[model samples]
Every structure is written in C-alpha cells, then in structure tokens.
Target: MRHAGPKLLTQIAAVHFVSHVHIMLIPALLPVLPGLLGVGFIELGVALAVFNIISALVQAPLGYAVDHYGARRVLKAGLLLGSLSFLLLAASPGYALLLVTMALAGLANGVYHPADYALLAKGIEPGRLGRSFSLHTFAGFLGSAVTPAIFLGIAAVLGTRAALAAGAVFGAAALLLISIPGSGVYRVAEVGNKGCAGPVPATGRVRLFTPMIGVLTVLFILLNLSTSAIEKFSVAALVQGQGLTLTWANTGLTAFLLCSAAGVLCGGALADRTRRHGLVAAMAFALAAALTALVALGVLWDWALVGVLGAIGLLTGIIAPSRDMLVKAAAPPGAEGKTFGLVSTGFNIGGAIGPVVFGWLLDRGLPSGVFVASVVFMVLTVGLTLAQEVFMARKGRGALRYQR
Candidate 1:
C-alpha cells in the first residue's frame, strides 16, 4: 500500500521526536540540579509544576494559532523558544530563574501539537492514521528514552550543566536542519482554500467528528496517568520493594522502554488495518493491569517479575498509539486547536498527578495501591471507549442520512 506522503510524515515525526526529548530532559536533568544548586524536592517539584502549568496555559492559544496559520511558522518559533529555555534552564543562576526558563519551555512546547495533529489528520489517509501516529509517537518515545544515555555520557565527559547545554544545542540543531534545502518546506499560506495544505477537500463538513474526539480526550488522560505511574514507580518497585540493586532496577526500566517502543509500532500497525482498535486498546489496558498486579503479588519466582513488568510497558505503549489513532480519526476540521489542546491538557494534568499520587501511596505502605489504581484507570478507559463508539456510530448515521 502506498504510504500517505512519506516525506510529510518524516517531517512531523522529527518535530514530534524533538518535542518529546525536550519533555524528557527534566527527569533526566533534575538530580543534578540539587547537587549543583542546593535545592530540595519541594523546590524542584514546584518548578516542574510551574513548567507544566505554563505549558497548559499556552496550549489553547498555540493550537488556535496553528489552526489559523499553519504548522511551519508556529513549530519553528516554538522550537526556538524551547531550545533557548533549555539552555537557560541548564545554566540558570537561581531556582527562580530555573522556574522561569521552564515556564518558557512550557509555552514553546504548547505550539507544536495542534498544527501537527491537524496536518496529519487532514493530509494522511484515514486508513493509515494509526500507523502514522504510532510511528510519530514512537519517534518521540525513542528520543526521550535515549536521552539519559546521551546526557549521562556528556555529563561524564563535560560535567552536568554542560551535558544539558548539549541537549539545547541539539534541539537548536533540529530547528536549523528543518530550514535547509529540500527539507519538506511548508507554505506559509496556501492560495486557494483547503485551509492551507490540508488533505481534506474544502467543502467537507467538520461537525461530523467532534464528540468522539472529546471521548478520546478522556481516555488520553486516564491512560497517561497509568503510564506516568509506571515511569515514576517502575524502578522504585524493583529497587526498593524487591531489594534489587539500583543498577538492576534501571536495567529493567530500559527493558520496559524497549519493549514498549516495539509495542507502539506493533499496535499502530494493527489499528491502522483493523476496526478492532478499541478491543486491542482495551486488552492492552487489561494486560498492564495484570502485570502490575503480578508485581504487587510478590510471587516473583526470581527476575521473571522484572520480565513481566517489561511486558506491561509494552501494553501501555500499544495503548498510546491506539489512543492517538482514535483522536486522529475523530479530529474534525476547524477544531484542531480545541480538541488537541484539550487532550494535551489531560495528558499534562495526568503526568503531574501520577507521581504525586503514586508517591503518596508508596509512602503509606501501599504497594498494591499502585497496581490497583492503574487497573482502575484502565477500567475507566473501557467506559470511555464505549462512549466513543456510541458517539461515532451516531455521527456515522448522521452522515449517511445527510448523504441520502
């Protein structure tokens, strides 16, 4: 089958990957902050929250601008500001300065999602959206996942702040790369309708696809919460709860990430071809729940528990791209800003909530709580999936009647 404009997908994937790397820089770089600047968890967490809050605040505007304008102008400027923020964040003199830099990074991140999603939703064939988004999100996952190795190596050779400075430099390099000759140039504004480079014909109606987008937004948040908990507690569970060495714990986390990335590709490929995305996404959720419970059960039978937990990572990965596909399919015209921004808000909110809530559970002698909570979150997605189906069915019928 012919792919939907391979060049465009490559362009979007590159930006998506960079956006994720910028997101991952925090947890990777946070430890050095305290040793270098003499701050506490409270201060660090507060700064992190400030960054997220700022991103959340600007996302709506960013999405709106992208809808009105196009991805090229918005993406370039956001990336430039984000790169600057990374540099400033790495070298900030005080905690206050760091927070300000993070806030700017937040704003920068805000500008990418809406226009990017709109482009994919409009330009790519509907049948291929799953695989495309999966590939896109996987690039992001790979970028974020590999950063520690890159950052740590740089830190070992050039010191911590310099290592982070390197990340900023790399980000800026991505910006420059996009500007070169034959780099998939985007028109600032197209001459005749299609609202600027969109694949959809100008006459296509948009209201036919809104409510389903809303349902998936709910799923995005809930599923993100489970993934955030895994990131926060996976290593802790292995090291602290199971008494494995930190190195071993970290190794297990790597295994999980690798498997998860593979799962993303597999799931996206499957969803792109089949109407069973909901079922597949649901099953992934259930598997994640089961594996988390197995860990809580403590029937490890040796390192097998670690192995099974890696599978859980894979399940969430699958769920992620499937969720992305649902949103893309439901992405109506003229509302990319409202829809993508709302979903992104849900994601950021969940990211902020997961660590705090799961940390509390861990502190309170509740190993099972994490597993239980993840299971509950996944179960909730089942309801959201059903709601999406009903909404889509209704929309499809409305379209049929209109056609008749």
Candidate 2:
C-alpha cells in the first residue's frame, strides 16, 4: 500500500504535467500561429475563445463522467483526444481547422481536474495526500513555466508544425505510461471503486449540489480572480503606474511566478502537518491582501516592489494545498470527482470574466486599480474561507449531537 501511493503519485503527476503542456501550447505558439495559419489576430482570438468556452461548458458534466465511468477510462480517452487534436492542427494549418481542433482540445482540457483529483484521492495514503496534491500541482506549473521557452525554441529552429508535433508526442507518451501493465493506475482504480455498483444514485448526485460545494466554487472563483489580476496585469500596472522600467516590472512578475511554485511545495508540507486548512488559507490570503494593497500604493522602491510581489506569490502559493485540502474535507465520500469538477469550473468562470474587468481598468488608465481589485478579491476569499470553516464546524457539532 505504501509503495503503491508513491508510484501512483509519480505517474499521475506526469500525466498532469503533460496536460498542462497541452494547455499552454497554443498560447506559447501564438506569435507564429497567426502567420502560419494565414489569419489575423482576431481570428486567432476567436479560436482561443472557442477553446475556453467549450472547456467551461463541459467541465461539470465531465466530472460526473469521471465518477461514473471510472477516472482511468475517462482520463485515457481525454489524453488520446487531446493528442489527436494537436496532431490534426499540425497536419492542417487553416483558420477553420484551427477552430475545430481547438474545440476538441478544450473538451480534452476539461478532463484533467476531475480525473486527476479523483485518482489522487483514491490512490494516495491519507497522510501523504496533501504532499501528493502539491507535487502534482507543482508539475503542472513547471510545465507551464517551461512551455514558452521550449516550444518557442522548437518553433524557431524546426517551425511551428514541429513544435506542435512535439506536444503530440509528449501526450502520447503519457497515455502509454498510464496504460501499461504494472503502472498501478488500474490497481488503484479497482481498489477505490470496490463495492460500487452500476451508476451513482440520485442521492449521491444531490450531494454534489450542496451549499458547501457552491461556496467552494465561489471560493475557487475568487482565488482565480485575485491571482489573475496580478499575473495578467500587475506588470503593466507597475510599469505604467509605478514608473518602473518594463524590465524591472517583468522581473517582479517572474519572481512572483517562480516563488508561487516554490511555495506550493512548502505549503504541501504545512498541509500534511495541520487540519486547519481554512485557517491556513484565510491567514495567507489576508496577509497577501495587505501586501497587494501595498503594491497598489505605488510608493515602494523598484527592488522593494519585486520583493513584495515575491512575498505575495509565496503567500498565494502557500494557500493552494490548504485550498485543495479544504475542498477534499468538504467532499462527500464517493463524490470526489464531482466536487472537484464543480469547483474547478470556477477557474474557467474567473478566467473568462477577470480579463475583461482588469483590461477595462487598464484601458481607462487605472493601472493601480488592477492591484486594488486583486486586493478586494483576496479579502473576499478570506471572508469566504472563514465562513466555510464556521459552517463546517456547526455541521460537525450538529452531527455529533445527533449521534449522542
């Protein structure tokens, strides 16, 4: 059992790493794609939009599928589907074809969260689950971090098509890794689903729609909204509002992202040590909110700004393992897929809405508003986290009294 946990974690993390690589492929190659497809930026933008919309629409339903059909089966299908989409793109480089391929890719993208989380929940030992989740997340972040440089370098030397072909190969390799005998994926799934009969009952389905899940969904949305502001707009804000050089602003953003990844690892250790995930998340967000507000003030030295952003990144990253732990704690048994799926949809929702709002502020020359808005979202998240803790505590007490 102990050996099985680490093996499963390693394989699942590799799968997650490839999943993120696929997600970033389009954005990474955007510069060359317009010219390659003989299309303008608007056409490309529409393709990207199509991808996000399809992903958002299907995520919840897919979560149910993961729970019903088994995570292993659904995940394999997603891997194959996503790989084929990219291979198709490499084969046919036309605007119309791009839209079709991206839509396919989007549906494939929706498969990762529910399937990955479901697998981890069932496979890893309880004591090690927090660290497993963090490592999995860290792998994805590493994928995104490396994609731009690796793919662009490939595109530069071998052309766009070859770069995409490389991604397809990566995905195919991941598929084989999971499918092979002795991978332990099959063993984990069998153990996890033991004693489960046909389909999930209506009662089980109802559990997914509870207020706890809804609040967690909102919490996920706020988390994404807060981070997106800093990630998508902070560099612009710092350069324009804080009078920093473009180089310095980008440097700060890099620090934030790198530290955020480092923080996830540290946060994993913290998560394993404590059950007060909500307190951890709430405190981290509260402190992060304060630091973000400081950035909005635009009064710090350039180096100071970089340091503050790095600090905020560490705080944000620290909350992530705890955030996943909170969701896991709230999830009803046998419903991990649906719960994770439903809450993860919040990422798409926030991703879709956040840019318009922050871009609007930037368009209107309210650069500082970007940081200010992030602060607002972080504060809201803290409130939500605390409220959830209260609710869960009350529910626990009620159950104890009923038992008595």
Candidate 3:
C-alpha cells in the first residue's frame, strides 16, 4: 500500500481543525447573537440544540456513505456544506433563518469523523496510525480551544459577518488543500492490503453491528459525559458548590484543557509503542475517575484543586488515542467509515444529555453530584473497556479454532 506519510497527516489534521472551528463558531458568537437577533437566550439555546440533534441523527448514515461513495468525495461535500452553513449564518435574516442555518451546519459536521477516520485507516502507515489519529484529535481540540479567541477577535475588528466570512474562507482553503494529489485522503481501493492493521475474518458472514461495537458506543457516551460535566459546569460548580473564587475555578478548567492537550501528545508516543490499547484506556480512565472523585470530596483548595483537575484531564487525554485504536480493532473489514461514524454518535448523544444532567444537579444544590456522576461514568467506561477486550479475545480464539 502507498504510505501517505506526513503530508496526508497534515492535510487530514488541518481539515479536522477547520471542522471543529466551524462547529464552535456559533457558540462563540452566541452571547452576541441575542442582542443582534432580538431573541432570548432560550431561543438561542434551542437553535444550538437543533444543530446538534440533526448532526447526531445523520452521523451514522454519513459514515455508511463514506464507505460506499469514497472518503474524499464525502469529505469534500461536508467541507463545502459546512462552509456554506457559515455563509448562511453570516446572512441569516431572522430566527427561523438562523435555525435552518444551524441544521445545515449540523449536517456538515456529522460527516466529518466517518470520512476523516476512513481516510486515516486507509492512508496512514500501520506503525504510526495511532499518532495519526492523535494528531487528528489534537487538531480538533486545538480548533475548539482557539475558536473563541480567533472568531471573537475577528468579530471585534471586522464585525460579526466578516468573522463568519473568514470561517467560510477556511473551509474553502481546506477543500483545495486536500484535493491536491499526494494528500492523505485516498479512494478505498487505492489502499493496498496493509497486514494486521486489525483485520476481520474474510470467510464468514461479516457483521458490523456487534456486542463489541455496542459496548464501544456506550463507552464513548460515558466518557463524554464525564468530560462534558467538567467542561460545561465545573467553573460554576466550583464557585457555587465549593465556594471557590471565580479566578481559581476558571484556572482549574483552563488547566484541565491545557493538560489534556499535552497528554494527547504524550499518548500518541505511547500508542506507537504498544498494541495493548485496551489496557491503556482502562488504566487512564480508572486513574481519571479517582482524581475526579477527589474533587467531589471538596477538600482541595486553590492550587490543589487546579492540580487535581489537571490530573483528570491528563489521564483522559491519554486515553483518546488508545480509545480510537480500540475502535479500529473492533471494526470489520471495509467498514471503517460506518463503525467510526456510529461510535462517534455517542459523543453527540452524551454531549446533548450531559449538560442537562449535570446542570440539574448543580441547580438542585448538589455540586458534589456533578463530580460524583462524572466518576461514576468514568468507572463505567473502565468496565466497558475491559469487557470489550475480553470479548475481542474470545472472538479471536474462536476464529483461530474455526480455522483449525
């Protein structure tokens, strides 16, 4: 098989970055929108929800399309549609228009992971596939991390419309870059048989939907629930529930994000060295859960609070590459797009439900419940990871026995 090498990694990572930036653009502009559009925050919230729900509904089907049509074609369409969604946002004339625009954005966002992962699965060298996945994820996190500053800065200087227009420009540029020959994205058949990049059996009737896939999906949801709790509510919970200063609270959140980014880089290196991805995920989530549980105790103060939160971030970040590898291991041949697409829906599902669940706990004067719930979910993730390994091992043994 042709190895796409660094160029491909860079191209895919760039798209991942732009896609995340586009996804986050609306949220960054949210506070400004109510005044501009003459609507209430509740209405704005509903618009955002519509975008996410639509994206969730379409993710799996889009993944299937990636396998059928081609990753490059589907990915280009997603990029184009995502860019157009921003253009629509820039020109949105009313609340109804804004709602329609967000739905467009969701459709564009939904196809990304399936196509992106499919490309990586086929294009990247086997030894470095884990790092390739890491870079792809890291690019996304960087996009989210930078969106507030990038768009808000543009909005301040050039006006909101210009800022959104700038987003459209980014999508166009990504489309052109990936369209170039020697870019990482390839047609499915262009990939030669790279041995043991986690292959499924060839003889039997293949099934993409399996107990392992279901368990992996649930694992993704639970992991995101823990993360969303911290990302969305940790600051407020720290202030109101733990009586921490806003400065300290925000610092903890910031530390969590920064450390998590750093941990992703570290995890990539570890991923290249080992195939025991399930063990890596299990240990990381288990450690993260313990650190999160400490925060629930509310005994830490100031720096200690930030330190513990950072620890949780680090552990979870380390789990990411391993988690992706685990999913790749469980995938049936030629089903990369559909499998990733299906599992990634868990993120949207968890993200949709997490805020409400964690927010309710905070509203009810149970701040500790936020952390406690996160720990519970993380523990569940640990269990799922272990169970998935056992199941995969059994299947492997059964396949070998059948061959004999």
Candidate 4:
C-alpha cells in the first residue's frame, strides 16, 4: 500500500471540524432554554446528563465496531444518526422526545472521535502523527471558537428554531458527504483509493504495554472530569454565588479554551523531542494551573486574569496529545476503538460525577469547593503519573510504552 495523502487528512478533518460545530450549538442554546422552553436548571441538567450518560454507555460498543467492522461503516452510520437526531430535537413536542434525541445525538457523537483518531493513527506515518492529531484537534476548536458568534447571530437574525434548523441542515450535509462513494474513512481505507492507502503494514506491540494504557486512561478520565467541573460550575459560581455578571464569567471560560488551543499547538511540535517527558511537563503545568484557578476565585480577575486561565487551557491541550500517543501505541490489535472507548468511558464517568459533586458543593454554599475539587482531582492524577513513572523505572519499564 502507498502512504496516506493530504486529501484524506483534510476530508477527515473536515468531518471532525463540522461535527464540533454541531455540538457547540447546544451550549449557547442553554442560556436561552429557560426563556424558550420554560424549563429550570434541574431540567437543563437532566437534558445534559441524559445526553452524556447515553454517550458514555454506548462508546465501547461503537468503538468495538470501528475496530472490527471498519470505520467507514461506523462513520457513515454515525453521520446519518447524528443528522436525523437533530430533527428529533426540532420535532420534539415534549421533554421526553428531547431526552431521546439528545441521548441519541450523544451516542452518535461518541462514534466519531475514537474511530476518526484510530483511523489517523493507522494511516499516517509516525513522524507526522503529532501534526496530524494537532491539526485535527485545532480544526475542532476553531469550529467551537466560532460557535458563540454563530449562535449570537442566529438567535438575533433568524430566531432560535430557524437557526437550529440551519444547524440540522449542516449536519445533514455532512451526513450526505460522508455517505458519498469513496468519500469517508471507509473508502479511504479501501484499496486503490490513492488517498487513504488503506491499512499500513506497521503495527505497534501494544498488549505488552497494558500498564501504560491503563494509567493513561485513568489520567484522561481525571482530566476530563476536572475540566468539566470547572466549566460547569465556574460560570454559575461567578454569576450567582460571587455576583459577577454572565459576560465576565464567560470571558474567563473562553480564556481557558483558547489557551488550550495554544497549548496543543506547542505540545504537538515538541512531541518528537520530549516524547513521554512532554506529558510530565504538561502535568506539572496542570498542577500550577489548578492552583492559579483556586487563587483567581479568591481574588478578582480582569483582562490579565484571562492570561492565567488561558494557561490552564493550554495545559489541557499540551498534555492531551502525549496521552493520545500513549493510547495509540498501547492499543491492542483490532481493539483501537475499544481502547479509546474505554478511555472515553472514563471521561463520561468523570463528566457525570464531576457536575453532580460540584453542584452539590455549590448548593451547600461552599463556593470554594468547586475549585478545591478540581485541585484534588488534578493532584490525584499527578500522583498517578509519578507513581507510574517510578514503577516503570524500578521494573525497567517491564512495559514498552516508552523507549529508553
């Protein structure tokens, strides 16, 4: 087989990029939901929980399909499912259908990531891995970054229903494009596609590195939960608890995501040099970042405060690619998706647990608990990282997750 080509990368990246655009529409809509639907925070929480819980449970099975059945089939099906699910959201005459649609959309959302990343891992040359992953991630972030503006514009010009309908149209277009003959990962993997080059002859010895895989999964889980905790509660804490305005609250949140984008770019470029050590550096940054977040809550953060929050976001992106590389290297044969699914499952668990606990603390009137919880989670993850490094060293890494 020949090497992978740029066209396929762009195609995969395009699908990934637009898919995020679809997801981000939900968050911006959250603020408007109460006025639009007469629902309160409890109902909104239920909506989000239902969507994510369904996603968490179904990821492993869908990922397993991506591993054995091929990404083409899974990707195409997910696209269709995703597009149709929005119609469910649009057609919902009641909360039950909304729940169903959101959960289905979540399931469809779960299908894309592991399959897409695993496909990239299999097809791309090793030297280009960091760039490929980073570009793909950046594409998604770029889509998300534009979401607020898009939502603001749509809500202003077309009204909520029409704007969302336009989004569904976008999803539908993606579904159609993904289904086109030789258009998606499946066809790219097909022989004679010229772009995807199908399966590479190279495969990593992953089973021997189970310990690394397990630890990495744990870290990803902790990281996702830690992030969700801050994102979910930080705004509410600032606005309601701390009495800051919504706009100011949002500025801090946006800073975090934007900085994360910067971190990923830097992390990707540095991977070839530091390899595993890049992750250690990222974790160290996260330690400092969590501390900063705690401090910011106690003090007043202004424009300069955005810089610190941005640094926190930067740590997430910088740390992520290294962890992804570890999982890619450690994935067992015919189990890339399942491996990712397991890791994603951990994310879901964190996603689920974090908000409830954080909200609980908030309801209890311990505004500091949210930041404290984030600190504790980060601390635990760092401890896990250090323990794994020490264990690997003493055992001579008796695992091959990283090279000497």
Candidate 5:
C-alpha cells in the first residue's frame, strides 16, 4: 500500500477542528444563554451536562458503527447534525427544544474521533502516525481557542442569533468540502462504498476492552475533568475566593490554553523521538499536578499566576501526543476505532460531571476546591499512567511497538 497523502491528514484534522469548534460554542455563548433561555446558571450547566452525558452513552456504539459500517457516513451525518443543532439554537425555542438540540449535537459529536482516527489509521504512513495524531489534536485545541473569538466577536456586533447562524454556516461549508469527490477524506471513504473498510485479521471481539485500555480510559476522564474544572471555574474561583481581579484571572486562563496549543506542537516532535511515551506522560502529569497544587494554595499572585498557568498548560499539553501514542500502543490489532472510541468516552464522562461538580463547589463558597480538585485529578492521572506502563510491560506489549 502507498503512504497516505497530506490531504488525508488535512481532511481528518479539519473534521476534528470543526467538531471542537461546535463543542465549544456553548461555553462561549453561556454568558448570554440565561437571558435568552430564561434559565439560571445552574440550568445552563445542566444543558451542557445533557450534551456530554448523551455523548458518553453513545460514543462506544459509534466506534462499533465506524468498524461495522464506515466512518464517512457517520462523519457526514455528524457534521450535518452539528450544524442543525446550531441552527436550532439560532431559532431560539423553549428549554425543551434546547435539550433536544443538545442531544442531537452530542450524538453527532461522538462519531468524530472514531471516524477521524480510523481514517488516519487506514490512510497515513505508519512512521508518521504520531505526528498526524498530534496535528489532529492541535487542530482541535486551536478550534477550542478560536471558538470564543468567533462566536463572541460576532455576537458583540451582530446579535447572538446571527452568531449561531454563522456557526451553522461554518459546519455546512465543512460538510461540502469533505463531500467533494477528489478530496483526500472522500477518496479514502469511497474505497469501501459501504463506509466499512475491508476485513483485516480479527483479534478477539472483546480484546479492545483490555485492562490497559480501561486504565487509559480513566486517564482520559481524569484529564478532561481536571481541564474542565480549571477552564470552567478557575476565573470565578480566583476572583471570588482568592481576591484576584477578573483581568488577571482571565489572563491566566488564556495563557494556559495558548501555551497548551504550543505544547502540542512540541509534543509532536517529541513523540517521534522516544518510545517511552508512558514515562513522558507520567513526568508531565507530575509537574502539572505540583503546579496546580500551587495554584490551589494561592501561592502565585498577579503576574506569577499567569506564569504558573502557562507552565502547567505546557506540561499538560506536551503529554497529549505521548498519551495518544500510549493508547495506540495498547490497542489490539484492528481495534483502532474501538479503543479510541472507548477511551474518548472518558472525555464526555468527565465533561458530563466536571461542570456540575465544580459549579457546585463555587456555589457552596468553596473556590479553593476548584484548583484543589484539579490537582487531585492530575495526581490520580499520574498514578494511572505509571500503572499503564507497568501493565504494558508485564504483558510484553510495550508502548509504540504496536504502531505497525
């Protein structure tokens, strides 16, 4: 088989990038949602939780769909439903309609990772898969960073309704681009018209659910929950609980996200350089945990807060590619979609719970609990990473050796 082309990478990355943008649109729009939806902050949080919970329930099935049917069909449907959800939002109906909208979006969002990763695995050269995975992750993070600017920036001038319309248009445009016949993602999907790739040698049907995969899944959950805690609650925690100004708090959050994107790039190069991805992830988590504990202690004030947040972001971001490498290393043969699908569910599970938990802490007048929770989760992730390393070693199926 020929090496996969750059077009495949771009197409898959584009799908990931667009899906993240849609996922983040709610957060960016949350400030104004209460006014529009006639609900309180907690109600808004519930809506977000509904989206995530639904996503968690469906992702594993979508993984099976990707293997049994085809990623192209699922991906195309995801893009369409994702767009429709925003259009429904633009319509600004009642709370019931909003819940339905989120459910549709959540179901659609679940298909992306399974589909995109499956496509990349089938298309990319083995030697370059790590970098491809990094680029894919980087695109998603970039999408997260940009969503606020796109949505809020537009809503500031135009109405929020117009902003939602624009988001819908964005998804529609992506769907059209990927649908084009000569495009890289399209060509690959066309190879198996039914959308399912031809059969490869089968491992056990349940092999994808190994203990190492479970550890990796938990690691993903902890990572997402920790990030969600920081992103959702840190600013308010700092301002209300720690006596920091809103400006400084927002600056810290921005530095964390921007530095994280930068770290993905660095991690991509580093992923290619070493096979000890488990060690790399462990070290990164340990440092991030320590820094987060400092944040929880309020040891850093003003400029120092921004500096510490940036450092934490960099350390955590650097682990991402290595983290992906570890999961790939643990997958049984021909189980790429199943493994990624299962592990990715951890993100939704965390997303489903993180906001409610952290928001409750803030509501109960426990701002310090936000950062404290982040540190605890990060520390737990470090333990899991080490355990995963030991498990893989004992199985004699070490990290990065399974790439082929």
Candidate 6:
C-alpha cells in the first residue's frame, strides 16, 4: 500500500495537470484562434464562456455519476472525451466547430474535481492525504502557469492547429499512463461508509445538501473570487491605480503567481501536522485580506508592491490545502464526488463573476477597487471559514452524543 500511494498520486496528478492544460489551451492561443477560425474575438470569447458555463452546470450531476459509476472509469472517459474534443478541433477548424468542441470540452472538464477527489479519498492513506491533495493542486497550478508559454511557443513555431493537437496528445498520454495494468488507480465505486469522519446519515444523498456543504460551497466561491481578482486584474490595478509601469506591474503579478505555487507545497505539510484545517484557512485569509487592503491603499513603492503581492500570493496559496481538507472532512464517506462537485461549481461561479466585476471597476477608472474588492471577498471568506469550523464542531459533538 505504501508503494502504491505515490504511484497513484503521480498518475492522478498527471491527469489533473493535463486537465488544466486543456482548460487553458484555447485561451493561450487566443491571438491566433480568431484569425484561424475566421471569427471575431467576441465569438472566441463566447466559446470560452460556453466552456465555463457548461462545466459549471454539469459538475454536480457528474459527481453523482462518479459515485454511481466507478471514479476511474468516469475519469478515463473524461480524459478521452476532452482529448477527442481537441483532436476534432485540430482536424476540422471552423467557427461553429470551435464552439461545438469547446462545449464538449466543457462537459469533459466538469469531471476532474469530483472524480479526482473521489479517487484520492478512496485510494490514498489518511496519514498523507493532505500532502496528496496539495501536490495534486500544485500540479494543476504548474500546468496553468506553463500552458501559455509552451502552447504559444508551439503555435509560433508550428501553427494553432498543431498546438491543439499537442494538447490532445498531452491528455491522451495522461489517459494512457493511468489506464496501464498496474497503475494503482481505484477500480471500484466507493459507496462504503468507511471514509466519513463524522456520523453519516442513513440517507447518504442528504449529505450533499447539508449546511456544512453549503458553507463550503460559499467558501469556495469567495476564495475563488478573491484569487481571481488578483490573477486577472492586479497587474492592471497596479499599473493604472498606482502609476506603475506595465513591466513592473506584470512583474508583481508573476511574483504573486509563483509564490502562490510554492506556498501550496508548504501548506500541504502544515495541513498534515494539524487537524485545525479551518483555523489554518481562516488565518491565511485574514493575513491575505490585510495585505490586499494595504495594496488597495496604493501607497507602496513599485518594489514594495511586488513584495506585497508575493506575500498575498503565498498566504492565499497556503489556504488551498487546508481549504480542500476542510471539504474532505465535511464530505460523507461515499459522497465525496457529489460533495466536491457541488462545491467546485462555486469556483466557476466565482471565476465568472470576478472578471465581470473587476473589469467593470477597471472600466470605471477604479483600478484600486480591484484590490479593495478582493480584500472584501477575503474577509468574507475568513468569516465563512470560522463559521464552518463552528458548524462542524457542533455537528461532531451531536454525533458523539447520539453514539453515547
């Protein structure tokens, strides 16, 4: 089992990496896609929006499928479907086809969180689960970080179609790796009650809609909303609001992203050492909120802005593992798929909303509002985290009393 643990983690993490790469592929090649498809940028944007909307809508139902059908099987099918979507795009490039392929990819994209978390919950040992989850998240961040440079470079040298084909190949390679005979992927549906930390109700279906899960869903939304603001608009905020040059603004954003990735590894270790995952998340969010507020003040020097953004990134990244751990704790034994799926939808929701809100702020000549709004989301997330901890504690005590 010990030997199998790392192998399983590696395979699943690779698939997650591929998923992120696929998610970013079209966006990375946006410069050339509009020309190739003979469509305006608006159409391409709509395609991207279609991808996100479909992913958000389908994720919860797909989670149920992951629990009913085996996770490994569902995950493999997702990989195949995602890969084929890109392959078909590469083979037949047109405006309508692009939309169709992106929608297909979106449905395929919805499978990752539910299927991936379900497999990890069932396959990994409890002792190292936090680290496993962190590594998985780090892999995704790495993929998203690198996709633009790698795929754009491919497009520059070869063509946009070639880049799409390369992405398909990447997914296919991940699929093949996990589908191997001794890959250690979980082969059975996880319907047993062994994985739940607290007393599970008789009707497992109710677990997906519990108040704790509702809190988690909201937490996920606020978390993503905060981070998405930083990721999408911080550079603009620094440039426009603080009068920093574009180069320096971009430099600060890069620092934030890189430090956030490093923080995830550190966070995994911290999550393993303590069971107070909610407290860890709350503290991280609090510090992050404070830093973001300072950034919003627009009083820092350019170098100081970079440093502050880096600190914010590290603090926010530190929250990821603990955040996932909290969700894992809240999930009922066999309902990890639906629970994670339901919560993960919040990411898409937050992702969709953050850009529009921040973009509006920027359009209104309120660049500082980007950081200010992010701070607001972060503080709300801190409160939500503490509230969730209280709820979980009360629920645990009630379960203990019932057992006694």
Q: How far out, in Å, is residue 396 in model 1?
A: 3.6
Model 3 weakest 10-residue run by lDDT: 187-196
Candidate 6 C-alpha error for residue 11, in Å: 0.3
lDDT of 4 by residue, 381-402 (tens): 7777677657656666555545
lDDT per model vs. reference: 0.72, 0.88, 0.85, 0.69, 0.83, 0.88
lDDT of 3 by residue, 114-136 (tens): 88888888778889988988888
* Local accuracy of candidate 6 as per-residue lDDT tens digits, 228-279: 9999888888888888999989998999999999899999999999988999
Better candidate by lDDT, 3 or 4? 3
Residues 25-47 of candidate 1 have per-residue lDDT tens digits of 76677767677668987898888
- TM-scores of the candidates are 0.88, 0.95, 0.94, 0.85, 0.92, 0.94
- Count of residue pairs whose backbone atoms collide, per candidate: 0, 0, 1, 2, 1, 0
> Local error of candidate 2 at 346, Å?
0.3
Q: Which should have the higher lDDT, number 4 or number 6?
A: 6
Clash pairs of candidate 6?
none
Best by TM-score: 2
Better of 1 and 6 by lDDT: 6
Mind giving the per-residue lDDT tens digits that candidate 2 earns over 264-344?
Answer: 999999999998899999999999999999999987777888899999999999988999998888777767777888889
Candidate 5 residue pairs in backbone clash? 70-195
Predicted structure 1, TM vs. truth:
0.88
Candidate 5 per-residue C-alpha lDDT over 1-404 given as tens digits, one digit per residue, 9 for 90 to 100: 33447988887888888999888887898877777778887777677778888899988888877766667877888899999998987887567777887888889899998888877877777678778888999999998889988899888888778887888888898798788886787556322244235554443355677777888899999999877787778899999888999999999999998888888888888888888898888899899999999999988998899999999989988999898888777766566677788999999888877877897999999999999999989989988889877776766754456664
Off by over 4 Å in 2: 1-3, 190-206
RMSD of 6: 3.1
Q: Which stretches of candidate 3 lie over 4 Å from their true place?
A: 186-206, 398-404
